[model samples]
Target chain A: MLKIIKPGLLTTVQDLGRTGYRHHGVVSSGAMDRNAHRIANWLVGNNESNATLEMTLMGPIIEVQEDALVAITGADLSPTIFGKPIANNRPIFLKKGSIIHFDRMKRGCRAYLAIGGGINVPKVMNSRSTDLRAKLGGYHGRSLVAEDILYIRKYSEHTKHTISHLRNQANQIDDFYQADWSVGRVSKIDNTYPIRVMKGRQFDWFTKESQASLVNKQFRITAASNRMGYRLDGNKLSQLKSQEMISEAVRFGTVQVPSDGNPIVLMADSQTTGGYPKIAEVATVDLSRLAQKKPGDMIDFTWITHKEAEQLLIKQEREMKQLLVGVQLRSYR
Target chain B: MEYKLSPMGDQSILIELGNTIDLATHDIVQHVVTCLDSMDHAWIIEYIPAFTSITVIYDPVQVLEIEANPFKSPYHIVANIIEEQIQQIAVLETKKQRTIEIPVLYGGEYGPDISIVAEHNHLTIEEVISFHTAGEYTVYMIGFAPGFPYIGGLPKRIATPRKTTPRSVTPARSVGIAGEQTGVYSIESPGGWQVIGRTPLELFQPNDPEPTLLQTGDKIKFKSVTKEVYDHLEAKLC
Candidate 1:
C-alpha cells in the first residue's frame, strides 16, 4: 500500500489500455510511452499489462506503507528515497516507511513507476487505464491527489518470489537495495530521433508539395497538445482536393490534416473516428519516441514502408520479451 | 462491391468499402464487421466501423504466435486473413437492426441553435422539428466521444452549416447537425454543430452493461416531447 504525499502535475493510474470498445467510441487511454511502462513492469516482475502510476512532467511524492519491490522507468524525474538518489530502470526494494519524492524532471515528458503487485484500481471496460475525457476508469476516474491511498493488487508468483529474494539479500547499510543489473540505455530512446511514419488512408489527397513539406519540415509540438492529440506547428499541409470526407476510424499516431493545414497526431486518448484527412501515421515503434516529446520540442518525420514499420515493432516486442525472461532469471539468482 | 485494404499502422488496417457515404457503402461496412465479430480471432483486438471504412486493430504478437516461424509481416498476414474471411461473408443476409427512439425537447434553452437551423433552411421552427422527427436516421458510426452516434438520413431541407466558432461547452445529449451529418453529444464536449434539440435519455452511461445506447448499423428516431415531459425525464436522469 502507498499514499500520495503530494500529487505533482498529472499523476494517474494506467495499464496497457482497454480494447474491444473502439467501435463504441471509447479511446484507448494508457501510458503514453508504452516502452517505458512495460520496462517498469518487467523490472518488478509484474504482468506487462499491470497498472502503473504515470507521472507526467512532474511527479508525486509517495509514502510507502508496505515493504515491496518497485521500479521507476521512463523520464528522469530525479527521484529520491529519503533524500538518497534512486536508480531508474531497475527493481528496488522500498521499506515500509520509506518516502519517495521526485524533485524535478530532468528529461522526457512522463515517468512510470510499477509496483511488484501492480495497483488496485477498478477495471472499467476490462482496463484500469484512466480516460480523463469520459471520467470512466482509474482511481475515481481522475488523477491522484494528496492523501489518496493506493492499494496493491494480489501478488503474483513472480512478484512474491522477487520480494523474498530482495529481502533475503538486504544489507545493514541501507534498507533499500537495487538489482545488480538494469534495463540498459540501449533500450532507452532519445526524443530527437526522427519519428518514422507511413502513408495514411488519405495520403494521396494531399498535394505533392504538401507531402514533401511534411517529410522535410521540422514541427514544433504545440502547447495545446494532450493525451487526445498533439497539435503540430509546422508547414501547413494543403490538400489537392477540397472535398468533404466522411468520418472514418482513426487510431493513436494518426496524423490528421484539418482545414487549418497544421497536422494533429492523435494519441492514446484521441477520438475513435475522425473526419479530417489523415496525411500520415506515425510508425508503431516510433510512437513511444513521439509520446515522450514535450511541448515546444521539435520533431521531424521520416517516411517508412508499411512492411518496415511492422518489422520494427516485432523486433522491439522480441527484445522486451527477452528482457522479461532475463529479469525473471535475475530474481531467481 | 470493390473495397481497398490499406495498412493504417503496424497494428491496424483500414478497409475502405466505397468512395461515397451512402446506405450501400455502410451496408458493406456492416457486413464486414458482423462477419469478423463471429470469427472471434484472439489476435483481433478491436473493430471501428465508420461510414465507408472499418479499422481492424490486431495484436501483432498474437498474430505471430498463431502463425509459425518465418512469416511475412504480421500486418500483411493479418490483413490477408481478414480479407479472405470477410470476402466469404460479404454477401450475407441482413441481420435484425436495432432501432432506438430518443425523446427530445426542441427549441428554448436546451436547443439554442434551433432558430439558426430554421433560418438557414428558410423554414419555420415547427417545420424544422417536424422534418427532423419524421425521418429515420441510420447510425453510421459511434465516435467523437464515447457512445456519440453519427446518424445519417437528415432531410436536405433542414441541413445547416456548423457554427463558425464552436461553443466552448455543449451540454451532453444535445442533438445537433453540421452539413449533412447529425449526431448527439453523448458527453459534454466543445462542438461546432448547430444544436436543434436535446435528448432526455442518456445516450452514454458508463455504468450500464452496454454503455452506448446505439451501435453501428442501428437506427434512430427522434420523438418530440413537451417541456413538461422533458423536465420529468431530466429530473429522473439525475
Candidate 2:
C-alpha cells in the first residue's frame, strides 16, 4: 500500500487508456508521456499497460506501507528518500515506512511512477485511466488527495526476485535501494526541435498564408493548456472561406483551428468528435515530446509524410522492445 | 461505396464518405463501420463512426507482424485492407433497427430554457412540446459527451438557435434542441442548446458492462410524461 502524504499539483492513475468506448463519446484519458509510463512499468517488471501514477508539474509525497519495488520515470521532479536523492529510469526498492517526496521540477513537466505489481484500481470501461470530466476510472474517479491510500497488486515473480536481490544490498542502508545500471533518459526534453505533423483533412480549406505560417511560425503554449488540449497563441491562421462543418472523428495530436483562428492541439483527454477545422496532426513519435512541454513554452511545427511518421513510430516500438529485453537481463544480474 | 481515405495521424485513418450530412452519407458510414467491426482484425485497435466519416485507429507494430509486406508502411497496409474489405461489403440489412422511446417531462423547473425555445420559434410552450414529440428522430451519432445522442429530424416549427451564452452546468437527462438537431444530455456538461424537457431514463451508466443506452444508427422517439411518472421512474433508477 502507498499512502499519499501530499498530493502535489495533479496526480492520477493511468494505463494505456480506455479503448472501444470512443464511439460512445468517451475520451481516452491516460498518461501524457506514454513512453515514460511504459519505461516505468518495465523497470518494475510490470506490463507496459499496467496502471501507473502520473504526476503533473508537481509530484506527490508517498509513504511506503510495505517493502516494494518501484520505478520513477519521465520528468525528473527530484525524488528523494531519507534526504538521499533517488535516480530515475531504474528499479528502486523502498523499505517499509519510507517517505518518498518529490521536490522542485528539474527538467520535464510530468513523471510516471510504477510499482512492482502496478496500482490496484478498479478498471472502468476496460481501463484504469482516470477521466476527470466523465468521472469514470481511477481512485474514486478522481485525482489523489492528501491521506489517500492506494493498494498495490500482488508482485510478479520477477518483482519478488528483484526486491529480494535489492534487499541484500540495502541491509546496511536506512531507507531505499537502487540498481547500479539505468535505462538512461528516454529522450531529452528540448523544445528546440520542431514537432513533426501531417496535413489534416481540412488543410486545403485554410488560406495559403495560414498554411505556410503553420510550418514557419513558433507558437507559444498558453496558460490555459491542460490534459485536454494546448491552446496555442501564435499567428492567427485564417481560412479561404468561412464554412460550417459537421462534427467528425478527432484524435490525440489533432491540431484544430476554431473560428478565433488560434490553433488548439488536442491531447490525451480530447473529445471523440469535434466540429472545428483541423489544420494538422502531430506525428505519434513526437507526441511524447509534446507532452513533456509546459505552458508558456515555445514550439515550432514541421511537415512530415505519413510513411515517414509510421517508420518513426515503428522504429520507436522496436527500440522499446530492445529496452525491455535489456531491463530483463539487468534484473537477472 | 465511393470514399476517400486519409491519415488522421500516424496511427489512425480517416474514411470520408461524403462532405454533406444526409441519410445517404450516413448509411454508407454505418455500413462501413458495421463491416469493419465484423472483421475484428488484430491490428485494428478501435474505430469511431461519425456523421460522414469513420476514424480507424490501428497498431503499427502489430500490423507489421500480421502483414506479409515488410516493405509497405503500416498505414498503407491497413488502408489496403480497409479498401479491399469495404469494396466487398454489401449494405447490412439483416441487423434489426432499434428505436428507443425516451419519456420526457417538459416545461417546468426541469427545463428552464423551454420558454426561450418557445419564444424564439414564435410558438406556445405547449405547441413546442407537441411539435418536438410529434417528430420521429434518428440518432445520427453519439458524441460530445458519453451516451449523448445527436438525434436528427427536428420539426421546422420547433427549430431554434443555440443560446448565446452556454450554461456552465446543463443538467443531465435534459432534452435539448439546437437548430435542426435534438438531443438529450446524458451527462452534466456545459452546453448552449436550448433545453425544453428532462428525461427520467439513464442514458449513461458508467459501471454497467454496456455503458451507453444509445448507439450510432439507432432510432429515437420522445414521449411526453407527467411529473409523477418522471419522479416514479427516477426513483426506480436509484
Residue clash pairs of candidate 1: none
Number of backbone clashes in candidate 2: 0
Q: For candidate 2, lDDT tens digit of each residue in A1-333?
A: 999999999999999988989999999998889999999999998988999999998888999999999999988899999789998899999999999999767788999999999999998999999999998899999999999999999888889889999999986656888888899645456666899999998999999999999999899999999999999997899999999988898889999999999999999999999999999999999999999989988889999988889889988888888899999999998
lDDT of 1 at A146: 99
DockQ of model 1, rounded to 2 decimals? 0.79
Winning candidate number (DockQ): 2
Runs of candidate 2 with Cα error greater than 4 angstroms are A185-187, A190-192, B91-94
Residue-by-residue lDDT tens digits, candidate 1, A242-332: 9898888888899999999999999989888889999998998887888888888898999999888888888888887888788788877
**Largest TM-score belongs to which candidate?**
2
Q: What docking class should model 2 receive?
A: high
Q: Which CAPRI level is candidate 1?
A: medium
Task: Report every candidate's CA lDDT.
Answer: 0.88, 0.90
| Tens digits of lDDT, candidate 2, B1-238 | 6899988888998898988878778878888877887786898988888889999989988999988697788888999999998888865542356888999999898888899888888899999989988998778888899998888889899888999999999999999999988999999999999988899998999889999999888878889999999999999998
